[model samples]
Target: MITAEGLTKRFADKTAVDDVSFTVQPGRVTGFLGPNGAGKSTTMRMIVGLDRPTAGRTTVNGAEYGRHRAPLTEVGVLLDAKAVHTGRTARSHLRAMAATHGIPNSRVDEVIDITGIGSVAGKRAGKFSLGMGQRLGIAAALLGDPHTLILDEPVNGLDPEGVRWVRQFVRHAASEGRTVLLSSHLMSEMAQTADHVIVLGRGKVLADADLGDLVRAWTTLGVRVRSPRAAELAAAIAGPAVEIVTTSPETLDVVGVPAARIGDLAAERGIPIHELTPTTGSLEDAYLALTGESVEYHSKEIA
Candidate 1:
Protein backbone atom coordinates (compact mmCIF):
# COMPACT_ATOMS: atom_id res chain seq x y z
CA MET A 1 0.00 0.00 0.00
CA ILE A 2 1.00 3.65 -0.50
CA THR A 3 0.37 6.28 2.15
CA ALA A 4 0.62 10.06 2.08
CA GLU A 5 0.29 12.04 5.30
CA GLY A 6 0.04 15.80 5.12
CA LEU A 7 2.00 15.66 1.88
CA THR A 8 2.80 19.16 0.71
CA LYS A 9 5.14 20.70 -1.86
CA ARG A 10 6.11 24.27 -2.72
CA PHE A 11 8.15 25.99 -5.41
CA ALA A 12 9.14 29.54 -4.40
CA ASP A 13 5.92 31.44 -3.68
CA LYS A 14 3.68 28.89 -5.37
CA THR A 15 2.25 25.84 -3.64
CA ALA A 16 1.96 22.84 -5.91
CA VAL A 17 0.56 20.30 -3.46
CA ASP A 18 -1.15 21.33 -0.22
CA ASP A 19 -1.18 18.98 2.72
CA VAL A 20 -2.69 16.15 0.69
CA SER A 21 -3.22 12.83 2.43
CA PHE A 22 -4.54 9.57 1.08
CA THR A 23 -3.87 5.83 1.01
CA VAL A 24 -3.66 3.68 -2.08
CA GLN A 25 -4.46 0.17 -0.96
CA PRO A 26 -3.30 -3.01 -2.59
CA GLY A 27 -5.39 -5.35 -4.75
CA ARG A 28 -7.23 -2.48 -6.44
CA VAL A 29 -6.76 0.26 -9.02
CA THR A 30 -6.85 3.75 -7.45
CA GLY A 31 -7.36 6.58 -9.91
CA PHE A 32 -5.94 10.07 -9.41
CA LEU A 33 -7.94 12.73 -11.26
CA GLY A 34 -7.61 16.49 -11.69
CA PRO A 35 -7.92 19.26 -14.21
CA ASN A 36 -4.89 20.91 -15.80
CA GLY A 37 -2.60 22.64 -13.25
CA ALA A 38 -4.23 20.79 -10.38
CA GLY A 39 -0.79 19.60 -9.14
CA LYS A 40 -1.23 15.93 -10.03
CA SER A 41 2.18 15.64 -11.65
CA THR A 42 3.87 17.23 -8.66
CA THR A 43 2.18 14.84 -6.25
CA MET A 44 3.22 11.80 -8.26
CA ARG A 45 6.74 13.16 -8.49
CA MET A 46 6.90 13.52 -4.74
CA ILE A 47 5.73 9.94 -4.25
CA VAL A 48 8.66 8.59 -6.26
CA GLY A 49 11.18 10.96 -4.58
CA LEU A 50 11.72 12.95 -7.77
CA ASP A 51 10.53 16.13 -5.99
CA ARG A 52 11.11 16.55 -2.31
CA PRO A 53 8.03 17.65 -0.41
CA THR A 54 8.15 20.88 1.56
CA ALA A 55 6.33 19.23 4.42
CA GLY A 56 5.04 15.79 5.49
CA ARG A 57 6.01 12.61 3.68
CA THR A 58 4.86 9.68 1.53
CA THR A 59 5.67 6.00 1.89
CA VAL A 60 5.35 2.89 -0.23
CA ASN A 61 4.84 -0.38 1.66
CA GLY A 62 5.64 1.37 4.98
CA ALA A 63 8.95 2.97 3.90
CA GLU A 64 10.07 6.01 1.97
CA TYR A 65 10.60 5.17 -1.72
CA GLY A 66 14.29 6.16 -1.67
CA ARG A 67 15.00 4.22 1.51
CA HIS A 68 14.66 0.83 -0.13
CA ARG A 69 17.93 -0.89 -1.13
CA ALA A 70 16.41 -2.08 -4.42
CA PRO A 71 13.91 0.69 -5.04
CA LEU A 72 12.91 -0.54 -8.51
CA THR A 73 11.91 -3.92 -7.09
CA GLU A 74 9.73 -2.19 -4.45
CA VAL A 75 7.96 0.32 -6.72
CA GLY A 76 7.72 0.81 -10.48
CA VAL A 77 7.03 4.23 -11.92
CA LEU A 78 6.12 5.57 -15.38
CA LEU A 79 5.93 9.33 -14.88
CA ASP A 80 6.69 10.26 -18.48
CA ALA A 81 6.74 8.06 -21.55
CA LYS A 82 9.09 10.42 -23.37
CA ALA A 83 11.64 10.56 -20.53
CA VAL A 84 13.75 7.87 -22.25
CA HIS A 85 16.93 8.61 -24.18
CA THR A 86 15.90 9.25 -27.77
CA GLY A 87 19.13 7.77 -29.14
CA ARG A 88 18.55 4.37 -27.58
CA THR A 89 16.36 1.63 -28.99
CA ALA A 90 13.43 0.26 -26.98
CA ARG A 91 15.31 -2.95 -26.18
CA SER A 92 18.43 -1.06 -25.15
CA HIS A 93 16.46 1.21 -22.85
CA LEU A 94 14.84 -1.69 -21.04
CA ARG A 95 18.14 -3.50 -20.83
CA ALA A 96 19.83 -0.48 -19.23
CA MET A 97 17.09 -0.17 -16.59
CA ALA A 98 17.24 -3.89 -15.83
CA ALA A 99 21.03 -3.84 -15.55
CA THR A 100 20.85 -1.24 -12.77
CA HIS A 101 19.03 -3.70 -10.47
CA GLY A 102 20.66 -6.91 -11.72
CA ILE A 103 17.37 -7.79 -13.47
CA PRO A 104 18.06 -10.47 -16.10
CA ASN A 105 17.74 -10.20 -19.88
CA SER A 106 14.96 -12.82 -19.65
CA ARG A 107 12.82 -10.45 -17.56
CA VAL A 108 13.45 -7.63 -20.02
CA ASP A 109 12.25 -9.86 -22.85
CA GLU A 110 9.22 -10.85 -20.78
CA VAL A 111 8.08 -7.25 -20.36
CA ILE A 112 8.70 -6.46 -24.04
CA ASP A 113 6.46 -9.37 -24.98
CA ILE A 114 3.97 -8.56 -22.24
CA THR A 115 3.66 -5.00 -23.55
CA GLY A 116 3.44 -6.30 -27.16
CA ILE A 117 6.36 -4.20 -28.33
CA GLY A 118 8.56 -7.07 -29.55
CA SER A 119 8.34 -6.03 -33.20
CA VAL A 120 9.58 -2.51 -32.39
CA ALA A 121 11.97 -3.54 -29.62
CA GLY A 122 14.98 -2.68 -31.78
CA LYS A 123 13.56 0.64 -33.09
CA ARG A 124 15.00 3.97 -31.99
CA ALA A 125 13.02 5.52 -29.12
CA GLY A 126 12.91 8.93 -30.84
CA LYS A 127 11.40 7.49 -34.01
CA PHE A 128 8.64 5.58 -32.22
CA SER A 129 5.13 6.95 -32.26
CA LEU A 130 3.47 8.19 -29.10
CA GLY A 131 1.61 4.92 -28.60
CA MET A 132 4.74 2.87 -29.10
CA GLY A 133 6.69 5.10 -26.74
CA GLN A 134 4.07 4.56 -24.08
CA ARG A 135 4.36 0.81 -24.59
CA LEU A 136 8.13 0.92 -24.16
CA GLY A 137 7.79 3.00 -21.01
CA ILE A 138 5.38 0.49 -19.52
CA ALA A 139 7.78 -2.32 -20.38
CA ALA A 140 10.50 -0.56 -18.41
CA ALA A 141 8.23 -0.08 -15.39
CA LEU A 142 7.34 -3.77 -15.33
CA LEU A 143 11.00 -4.73 -15.74
CA GLY A 144 11.38 -5.08 -11.97
CA ASP A 145 7.94 -6.65 -11.41
CA PRO A 146 7.61 -4.32 -8.43
CA HIS A 147 4.95 -4.73 -5.78
CA THR A 148 3.55 -1.25 -6.51
CA LEU A 149 2.99 0.59 -9.81
CA ILE A 150 2.60 4.32 -10.32
CA LEU A 151 1.67 5.31 -13.85
CA ASP A 152 0.82 8.78 -15.13
CA GLU A 153 -1.38 8.89 -18.20
CA PRO A 154 -0.51 5.38 -19.29
CA VAL A 155 -3.10 5.50 -22.09
CA ASN A 156 -2.40 9.04 -23.22
CA GLY A 157 -1.65 8.07 -26.84
CA LEU A 158 -2.92 4.50 -27.01
CA ASP A 159 -5.31 3.15 -29.60
CA PRO A 160 -8.53 1.41 -28.65
CA GLU A 161 -6.87 -2.00 -28.55
CA GLY A 162 -3.92 -0.63 -26.56
CA VAL A 163 -6.28 1.05 -24.12
CA ARG A 164 -8.14 -2.21 -23.52
CA TRP A 165 -4.90 -4.06 -23.05
CA VAL A 166 -3.77 -1.61 -20.35
CA ARG A 167 -7.09 -1.85 -18.58
CA GLN A 168 -6.90 -5.63 -18.44
CA PHE A 169 -3.23 -5.58 -17.46
CA VAL A 170 -3.81 -3.28 -14.48
CA ARG A 171 -6.80 -5.31 -13.35
CA HIS A 172 -4.72 -8.47 -13.51
CA ALA A 173 -1.96 -6.80 -11.54
CA ALA A 174 -4.43 -5.79 -8.83
CA SER A 175 -5.89 -9.29 -8.74
CA GLU A 176 -2.43 -10.60 -8.02
CA GLY A 177 -2.32 -8.28 -4.93
CA ARG A 178 -0.25 -5.44 -6.35
CA THR A 179 -0.83 -1.79 -5.56
CA VAL A 180 -1.71 0.40 -8.54
CA LEU A 181 -2.05 4.19 -8.47
CA LEU A 182 -2.49 5.85 -11.83
CA SER A 183 -3.38 9.33 -13.08
CA SER A 184 -5.47 9.97 -16.18
CA HIS A 185 -7.57 12.72 -17.75
CA LEU A 186 -9.88 10.24 -19.45
CA MET A 187 -12.97 10.24 -17.27
CA SER A 188 -14.81 7.54 -19.17
CA GLU A 189 -11.85 5.20 -19.08
CA MET A 190 -11.25 5.91 -15.40
CA ALA A 191 -14.88 5.16 -14.62
CA GLN A 192 -14.45 1.76 -16.19
CA THR A 193 -10.98 1.07 -14.87
CA ALA A 194 -10.75 2.44 -11.32
CA ASP A 195 -12.14 0.83 -8.18
CA HIS A 196 -11.63 4.08 -6.20
CA VAL A 197 -11.07 7.73 -7.12
CA ILE A 198 -9.11 10.61 -5.61
CA VAL A 199 -9.95 14.03 -6.99
CA LEU A 200 -7.63 17.04 -6.72
CA GLY A 201 -8.36 20.67 -7.50
CA ARG A 202 -5.87 23.55 -7.34
CA GLY A 203 -3.47 21.57 -5.12
CA LYS A 204 -6.18 20.64 -2.60
CA VAL A 205 -7.70 17.22 -2.20
CA LEU A 206 -11.33 17.64 -3.19
CA ALA A 207 -12.55 14.08 -2.87
CA ASP A 208 -11.37 10.58 -2.05
CA ALA A 209 -13.89 7.75 -2.04
CA ASP A 210 -15.17 4.67 -3.74
CA LEU A 211 -16.35 5.21 -7.32
CA GLY A 212 -20.03 4.63 -6.57
CA ASP A 213 -20.04 6.78 -3.43
CA LEU A 214 -18.35 9.67 -5.20
CA VAL A 215 -20.97 9.70 -7.94
CA ARG A 216 -23.87 9.38 -5.55
CA ALA A 217 -22.59 12.04 -3.18
CA TRP A 218 -21.84 14.72 -5.74
CA THR A 219 -24.79 14.41 -8.17
CA THR A 220 -28.45 14.38 -7.39
CA LEU A 221 -30.91 12.03 -9.05
CA GLY A 222 -32.76 13.84 -11.82
CA VAL A 223 -36.19 12.93 -13.14
CA ARG A 224 -37.27 13.06 -16.79
CA VAL A 225 -40.94 13.74 -17.28
CA ARG A 226 -42.92 13.62 -20.49
CA SER A 227 -46.29 15.30 -20.29
CA PRO A 228 -48.43 17.39 -22.59
CA ARG A 229 -48.54 20.18 -19.99
CA ALA A 230 -44.83 20.13 -19.35
CA ALA A 231 -44.56 23.90 -18.92
CA GLU A 232 -47.38 23.94 -16.39
CA LEU A 233 -45.85 21.06 -14.43
CA ALA A 234 -42.50 22.82 -14.43
CA ALA A 235 -43.96 26.06 -13.09
CA ALA A 236 -45.86 24.20 -10.39
CA ILE A 237 -42.73 22.40 -9.24
CA ALA A 238 -40.51 25.46 -9.54
CA GLY A 239 -39.24 26.62 -6.11
CA PRO A 240 -36.02 27.30 -4.26
CA ALA A 241 -33.35 24.68 -5.20
CA VAL A 242 -35.77 23.05 -7.62
CA GLU A 243 -34.71 23.30 -11.24
CA ILE A 244 -36.89 22.43 -14.20
CA VAL A 245 -35.75 22.61 -17.79
CA THR A 246 -38.07 22.25 -20.72
CA THR A 247 -36.32 19.99 -23.21
CA SER A 248 -39.30 19.93 -25.57
CA PRO A 249 -42.87 21.17 -25.74
CA GLU A 250 -43.95 17.95 -24.02
CA THR A 251 -40.88 17.00 -21.99
CA LEU A 252 -39.26 18.37 -18.83
CA ASP A 253 -36.05 17.55 -16.99
CA VAL A 254 -36.40 18.09 -13.27
CA VAL A 255 -33.68 18.32 -10.61
CA GLY A 256 -33.55 18.92 -6.84
CA VAL A 257 -36.80 16.93 -6.62
CA PRO A 258 -37.50 13.24 -6.60
CA ALA A 259 -39.47 11.30 -9.24
CA ALA A 260 -42.16 10.46 -6.71
CA ARG A 261 -42.67 14.14 -5.92
CA ILE A 262 -42.83 15.05 -9.59
CA GLY A 263 -45.28 12.27 -10.31
CA ASP A 264 -47.49 13.24 -7.39
CA LEU A 265 -47.48 16.91 -8.39
CA ALA A 266 -48.30 16.05 -12.01
CA ALA A 267 -51.20 13.79 -10.95
CA GLU A 268 -52.67 16.40 -8.64
CA ARG A 269 -52.55 18.99 -11.45
CA GLY A 270 -54.39 16.61 -13.79
CA ILE A 271 -51.40 16.54 -16.20
CA PRO A 272 -51.29 13.64 -18.61
CA ILE A 273 -48.01 11.88 -17.80
CA HIS A 274 -46.67 9.68 -20.59
CA GLU A 275 -43.32 8.92 -19.01
CA LEU A 276 -41.57 9.49 -15.71
CA THR A 277 -38.07 8.12 -15.58
CA PRO A 278 -35.24 8.66 -13.11
CA THR A 279 -31.89 9.57 -14.63
CA THR A 280 -28.85 8.07 -12.91
CA GLY A 281 -25.85 10.34 -12.60
CA SER A 282 -22.60 9.48 -14.35
CA LEU A 283 -18.98 9.90 -13.17
CA GLU A 284 -18.54 12.82 -15.57
CA ASP A 285 -21.58 14.53 -14.15
CA ALA A 286 -20.30 14.18 -10.61
CA TYR A 287 -16.82 15.34 -11.56
CA LEU A 288 -18.10 18.45 -13.32
CA ALA A 289 -20.41 19.34 -10.47
CA LEU A 290 -17.65 19.01 -7.90
CA THR A 291 -14.93 20.80 -9.86
CA GLY A 292 -17.05 23.39 -11.61
CA GLU A 293 -15.84 26.17 -9.32
CA SER A 294 -12.25 24.90 -9.05
CA VAL A 295 -11.46 24.84 -12.79
CA GLU A 296 -8.67 27.35 -13.41
CA TYR A 297 -8.60 27.59 -17.19
CA HIS A 298 -11.86 28.30 -18.95
CA SER A 299 -12.41 28.29 -22.69
CA LYS A 300 -14.08 31.25 -24.26
CA GLU A 301 -17.45 30.64 -25.83
CA ILE A 302 -17.59 30.87 -29.63
CA ALA A 303 -20.02 33.42 -30.85
Candidate 2:
Protein backbone atom coordinates (compact mmCIF):
# COMPACT_ATOMS: atom_id res chain seq x y z
CA MET A 1 0.00 0.00 0.00
CA ILE A 2 3.01 2.26 0.51
CA THR A 3 6.28 2.26 -1.42
CA ALA A 4 9.44 4.32 -1.29
CA GLU A 5 12.19 4.36 -3.88
CA GLY A 6 15.67 5.65 -3.05
CA LEU A 7 14.15 8.03 -0.52
CA THR A 8 16.78 10.45 0.78
CA LYS A 9 16.57 13.35 3.20
CA ARG A 10 19.30 15.75 4.35
CA PHE A 11 19.65 18.33 7.09
CA ALA A 12 22.55 20.70 6.60
CA ASP A 13 25.47 18.33 5.73
CA LYS A 14 24.08 15.32 7.51
CA THR A 15 21.82 12.91 5.67
CA ALA A 16 18.89 12.00 7.85
CA VAL A 17 17.81 9.20 5.52
CA ASP A 18 20.09 7.85 2.78
CA ASP A 19 18.70 6.21 -0.32
CA VAL A 20 16.41 4.07 1.83
CA SER A 21 13.93 1.93 -0.03
CA PHE A 22 11.17 -0.31 1.34
CA THR A 23 7.53 -1.23 0.98
CA VAL A 24 4.68 -1.52 3.45
CA GLN A 25 2.24 -4.01 2.05
CA PRO A 26 -1.40 -4.52 2.80
CA GLY A 27 -2.78 -7.12 5.28
CA ARG A 28 0.28 -7.04 7.53
CA VAL A 29 1.91 -4.88 10.17
CA THR A 30 5.35 -3.67 9.06
CA GLY A 31 7.71 -2.51 11.78
CA PHE A 32 10.18 0.32 11.08
CA LEU A 33 12.95 -0.04 13.66
CA GLY A 34 16.25 1.76 14.28
CA PRO A 35 18.39 3.39 16.91
CA ASN A 36 17.64 6.85 18.27
CA GLY A 37 19.40 8.79 15.49
CA ALA A 38 18.56 6.36 12.69
CA GLY A 39 16.13 8.54 10.68
CA LYS A 40 12.97 6.59 11.50
CA SER A 41 10.92 9.68 12.34
CA THR A 42 12.28 11.51 9.29
CA THR A 43 11.18 8.67 7.01
CA MET A 44 7.76 8.58 8.64
CA ARG A 45 7.39 12.36 8.41
CA MET A 46 8.20 12.22 4.71
CA ILE A 47 5.64 9.47 4.10
CA VAL A 48 2.89 11.69 5.52
CA GLY A 49 4.03 14.91 3.78
CA LEU A 50 5.20 16.49 7.03
CA ASP A 51 8.80 16.64 5.75
CA ARG A 52 10.15 16.82 2.20
CA PRO A 53 12.80 14.37 1.06
CA THR A 54 15.95 15.78 -0.52
CA ALA A 55 16.04 13.01 -3.14
CA GLY A 56 13.78 10.24 -4.41
CA ARG A 57 10.27 9.99 -3.06
CA THR A 58 7.58 7.76 -1.54
CA THR A 59 4.00 7.17 -2.59
CA VAL A 60 0.88 6.10 -0.76
CA ASN A 61 -1.09 4.01 -3.26
CA GLY A 62 -0.21 5.48 -6.71
CA ALA A 63 0.31 9.18 -5.94
CA GLU A 64 2.47 11.27 -3.62
CA TYR A 65 0.77 12.01 -0.31
CA GLY A 66 0.53 15.74 -1.04
CA ARG A 67 -1.32 15.14 -4.30
CA HIS A 68 -4.12 13.27 -2.58
CA ARG A 69 -7.27 15.36 -2.38
CA ALA A 70 -8.30 13.74 0.94
CA PRO A 71 -4.98 13.02 2.65
CA LEU A 72 -6.61 12.35 5.99
CA THR A 73 -8.75 9.70 4.34
CA GLU A 74 -5.74 8.20 2.57
CA VAL A 75 -3.42 7.92 5.57
CA GLY A 76 -4.07 8.27 9.27
CA VAL A 77 -0.94 9.38 11.12
CA LEU A 78 -0.09 9.62 14.82
CA LEU A 79 3.39 11.05 14.69
CA ASP A 80 3.11 13.01 17.92
CA ALA A 81 0.46 12.29 20.47
CA LYS A 82 1.29 15.45 22.35
CA ALA A 83 0.91 17.69 19.30
CA VAL A 84 -2.66 18.48 20.30
CA HIS A 85 -3.76 21.78 21.81
CA THR A 86 -3.83 21.51 25.58
CA GLY A 87 -6.63 24.03 26.01
CA ARG A 88 -9.08 22.07 23.91
CA THR A 89 -11.23 19.22 25.16
CA ALA A 90 -10.70 15.72 23.73
CA ARG A 91 -13.98 15.80 21.83
CA SER A 92 -13.18 19.25 20.51
CA HIS A 93 -9.86 18.04 19.22
CA LEU A 94 -11.53 15.28 17.21
CA ARG A 95 -14.19 17.69 16.00
CA ALA A 96 -11.55 20.10 14.73
CA MET A 97 -9.68 17.37 12.84
CA ALA A 98 -12.89 15.97 11.40
CA ALA A 99 -13.81 19.49 10.29
CA THR A 100 -10.75 19.55 8.05
CA HIS A 101 -12.27 16.80 5.87
CA GLY A 102 -15.81 18.03 6.38
CA ILE A 103 -16.69 14.86 8.33
CA PRO A 104 -19.78 15.13 10.44
CA ASN A 105 -19.95 15.53 14.25
CA SER A 106 -21.47 12.03 14.59
CA ARG A 107 -18.35 10.58 12.97
CA VAL A 108 -16.26 12.41 15.56
CA ASP A 109 -18.28 10.75 18.33
CA GLU A 110 -17.92 7.39 16.60
CA VAL A 111 -14.14 7.59 16.70
CA ILE A 112 -14.14 8.89 20.23
CA ASP A 113 -16.21 5.91 21.28
CA ILE A 114 -14.12 3.54 19.21
CA THR A 115 -10.99 4.77 20.96
CA GLY A 116 -12.69 4.29 24.35
CA ILE A 117 -12.37 7.99 25.19
CA GLY A 118 -16.08 8.59 25.61
CA SER A 119 -15.81 9.46 29.31
CA VAL A 120 -12.86 11.83 28.75
CA ALA A 121 -14.47 13.42 25.69
CA GLY A 122 -15.47 16.48 27.72
CA LYS A 123 -12.25 16.71 29.76
CA ARG A 124 -9.44 19.14 28.95
CA ALA A 125 -6.60 17.43 27.13
CA GLY A 126 -4.07 19.20 29.34
CA LYS A 127 -5.35 17.29 32.36
CA PHE A 128 -5.30 13.89 30.61
CA SER A 129 -2.60 11.31 31.26
CA LEU A 130 -0.08 10.32 28.61
CA GLY A 131 -2.02 7.17 27.76
CA MET A 132 -5.22 9.12 27.59
CA GLY A 133 -3.61 11.70 25.31
CA GLN A 134 -2.34 8.92 23.08
CA ARG A 135 -5.88 7.56 22.87
CA LEU A 136 -7.10 10.98 21.84
CA GLY A 137 -4.48 11.13 19.11
CA ILE A 138 -5.49 7.69 17.89
CA ALA A 139 -9.08 8.85 17.91
CA ALA A 140 -8.10 11.66 15.56
CA ALA A 141 -6.21 9.28 13.33
CA LEU A 142 -9.13 6.86 13.15
CA LEU A 143 -11.60 9.66 12.64
CA GLY A 144 -10.82 9.55 8.95
CA ASP A 145 -11.00 5.74 8.83
CA PRO A 146 -8.01 5.75 6.52
CA HIS A 147 -6.73 2.53 4.96
CA THR A 148 -3.09 3.24 5.81
CA LEU A 149 -1.70 4.09 9.24
CA ILE A 150 1.75 5.51 9.90
CA LEU A 151 2.38 5.52 13.62
CA ASP A 152 5.69 6.58 15.21
CA GLU A 153 6.47 5.29 18.70
CA PRO A 154 2.77 4.90 19.35
CA VAL A 155 3.07 2.76 22.49
CA ASN A 156 5.39 5.16 24.29
CA GLY A 157 3.22 5.98 27.32
CA LEU A 158 0.63 3.21 27.13
CA ASP A 159 0.06 0.93 30.05
CA PRO A 160 0.28 -2.83 29.58
CA GLU A 161 -3.44 -3.03 28.86
CA GLY A 162 -3.35 -0.11 26.49
CA VAL A 163 -0.28 -1.55 24.81
CA ARG A 164 -2.09 -4.81 24.19
CA TRP A 165 -5.03 -2.88 22.87
CA VAL A 166 -2.82 -1.02 20.40
CA ARG A 167 -1.22 -4.27 19.22
CA GLN A 168 -4.57 -5.94 18.59
CA PHE A 169 -5.81 -2.71 17.06
CA VAL A 170 -3.10 -2.80 14.41
CA ARG A 171 -3.57 -6.49 13.77
CA HIS A 172 -7.30 -6.03 13.32
CA ALA A 173 -6.74 -3.14 10.92
CA ALA A 174 -4.23 -5.14 8.91
CA SER A 175 -6.52 -8.17 8.92
CA GLU A 176 -8.97 -6.03 7.00
CA GLY A 177 -6.29 -5.38 4.31
CA ARG A 178 -5.12 -2.03 5.68
CA THR A 179 -1.45 -1.09 5.61
CA VAL A 180 0.34 -0.37 8.88
CA LEU A 181 3.79 1.14 9.31
CA LEU A 182 4.89 1.33 12.93
CA SER A 183 8.17 2.83 14.16
CA SER A 184 9.69 1.98 17.50
CA HIS A 185 13.08 1.50 19.14
CA LEU A 186 11.86 -1.04 21.65
CA MET A 187 12.91 -4.45 20.44
CA SER A 188 10.64 -6.53 22.66
CA GLU A 189 7.59 -4.48 21.80
CA MET A 190 8.30 -4.76 18.09
CA ALA A 191 8.89 -8.48 18.43
CA GLN A 192 5.41 -8.88 19.80
CA THR A 193 3.57 -6.45 17.54
CA ALA A 194 5.23 -6.51 14.11
CA ASP A 195 4.52 -9.14 11.45
CA HIS A 196 7.36 -7.90 9.23
CA VAL A 197 10.44 -6.15 10.62
CA ILE A 198 12.79 -3.61 9.03
CA VAL A 199 16.04 -2.87 10.82
CA LEU A 200 17.87 0.38 10.12
CA GLY A 201 21.24 1.77 11.08
CA ARG A 202 23.17 4.95 10.33
CA GLY A 203 20.36 6.23 8.07
CA LYS A 204 20.38 3.08 5.94
CA VAL A 205 18.43 -0.12 5.65
CA LEU A 206 20.12 -2.99 7.47
CA ALA A 207 17.63 -5.86 7.34
CA ASP A 208 14.14 -5.93 5.87
CA ALA A 209 12.36 -9.25 6.18
CA ASP A 210 9.57 -11.14 7.83
CA LEU A 211 9.42 -11.06 11.62
CA GLY A 212 9.01 -14.85 11.49
CA ASP A 213 12.56 -15.30 10.20
CA LEU A 214 14.79 -12.76 11.91
CA VAL A 215 18.42 -13.18 10.83
CA ARG A 216 20.24 -15.95 12.73
CA ALA A 217 22.29 -13.42 14.66
CA TRP A 218 19.22 -11.97 16.35
CA THR A 219 18.81 -15.42 17.85
CA THR A 220 21.90 -17.33 18.93
CA LEU A 221 19.79 -20.52 18.53
CA GLY A 222 22.00 -22.43 20.93
CA VAL A 223 21.58 -25.47 23.07
CA ARG A 224 22.55 -25.82 26.73
CA VAL A 225 24.12 -28.94 28.23
CA ARG A 226 24.78 -29.79 31.83
CA SER A 227 27.15 -32.74 32.11
CA PRO A 228 29.04 -34.09 35.08
CA ARG A 229 32.40 -33.82 33.26
CA ALA A 230 32.10 -30.32 31.77
CA ALA A 231 35.81 -30.15 31.01
CA GLU A 232 35.81 -33.32 28.91
CA LEU A 233 32.68 -32.18 27.04
CA ALA A 234 34.22 -28.80 26.22
CA ALA A 235 37.41 -30.50 24.99
CA ALA A 236 35.54 -32.85 22.63
CA ILE A 237 33.82 -30.17 20.49
CA ALA A 238 36.13 -27.17 20.94
CA GLY A 239 35.40 -25.33 17.68
CA PRO A 240 34.19 -21.83 16.69
CA ALA A 241 30.54 -22.95 16.82
CA VAL A 242 30.99 -24.29 20.34
CA GLU A 243 31.91 -21.98 23.19
CA ILE A 244 31.69 -23.06 26.82
CA VAL A 245 31.57 -19.96 28.94
CA THR A 246 31.99 -20.70 32.63
CA THR A 247 28.99 -20.11 34.82
CA SER A 248 29.70 -22.55 37.63
CA PRO A 249 31.96 -25.57 38.20
CA GLU A 250 29.13 -28.01 37.49
CA THR A 251 27.37 -25.90 34.82
CA LEU A 252 28.49 -24.54 31.45
CA ASP A 253 26.82 -21.88 29.37
CA VAL A 254 27.09 -23.48 25.95
CA VAL A 255 26.25 -21.33 22.93
CA GLY A 256 26.43 -21.51 19.09
CA VAL A 257 25.81 -25.31 18.81
CA PRO A 258 22.97 -27.75 19.07
CA ALA A 259 22.13 -29.63 22.28
CA ALA A 260 21.72 -32.89 20.40
CA ARG A 261 25.32 -32.84 19.25
CA ILE A 262 26.46 -32.02 22.72
CA GLY A 263 24.47 -34.98 24.03
CA ASP A 264 25.90 -37.27 21.36
CA LEU A 265 29.45 -36.17 22.15
CA ALA A 266 28.85 -36.60 25.88
CA ALA A 267 27.35 -40.09 25.48
CA GLU A 268 30.15 -41.19 23.14
CA ARG A 269 32.82 -40.14 25.66
CA GLY A 270 30.97 -41.52 28.70
CA ILE A 271 30.36 -37.99 30.06
CA PRO A 272 27.15 -38.03 32.10
CA ILE A 273 24.69 -35.34 31.01
CA HIS A 274 22.13 -33.88 33.41
CA GLU A 275 20.27 -31.08 31.61
CA LEU A 276 19.73 -30.01 27.98
CA THR A 277 17.87 -26.91 26.91
CA PRO A 278 17.52 -24.71 23.87
CA THR A 279 17.98 -20.96 24.03
CA THR A 280 16.43 -18.44 21.62
CA GLY A 281 17.90 -15.12 20.48
CA SER A 282 16.51 -11.69 21.25
CA LEU A 283 15.72 -8.84 18.83
CA GLU A 284 18.39 -6.67 20.50
CA ASP A 285 21.07 -9.24 19.76
CA ALA A 286 19.96 -9.50 16.13
CA TYR A 287 19.81 -5.72 15.72
CA LEU A 288 23.24 -5.25 17.31
CA ALA A 289 24.80 -7.92 15.12
CA LEU A 290 23.21 -6.51 11.95
CA THR A 291 24.33 -2.93 12.67
CA GLY A 292 27.40 -3.57 14.76
CA GLU A 293 29.69 -1.21 12.84
CA SER A 294 27.04 1.00 11.26
CA VAL A 295 25.76 2.66 14.42
CA GLU A 296 26.13 6.46 14.30
CA TYR A 297 27.22 6.87 17.93
CA HIS A 298 29.51 4.12 19.11
CA SER A 299 30.86 4.18 22.61
CA LYS A 300 34.53 5.07 22.38
CA GLU A 301 35.24 3.28 25.64
CA ILE A 302 34.09 -0.10 24.26
CA ALA A 303 32.23 -0.40 20.92
**C-alpha lDDT of all candidate models, in order:** 0.93, 0.86
Candidate 2 lDDT over residue span 186-285, tens digit each: 7888888889988878789988899868746466676666777878888887897666776667677787667888888888888998988887777777
* TM-scores for every candidate against the unseen true structure: 0.90, 0.90
lDDT of predicted model 1? 0.93
Candidate RMSDs in Å, in order, are: 2.4, 2.6
277: Cα error in model 1, Å: 3.1
Write the residue-wise lDDT of candidate 1 on 1-303 in tens digits.
Answer: 999999999999999899999999999999999889889999999999999999999999999999999998999899999999999999999999999999999999999999999999998999999999999989988989999999999998999999999999999999999999989988899999999999999999999999999999988789999988888888989999998888999998888899898889888989889999998788999999988888889999899
Clashing pairs in 1: none
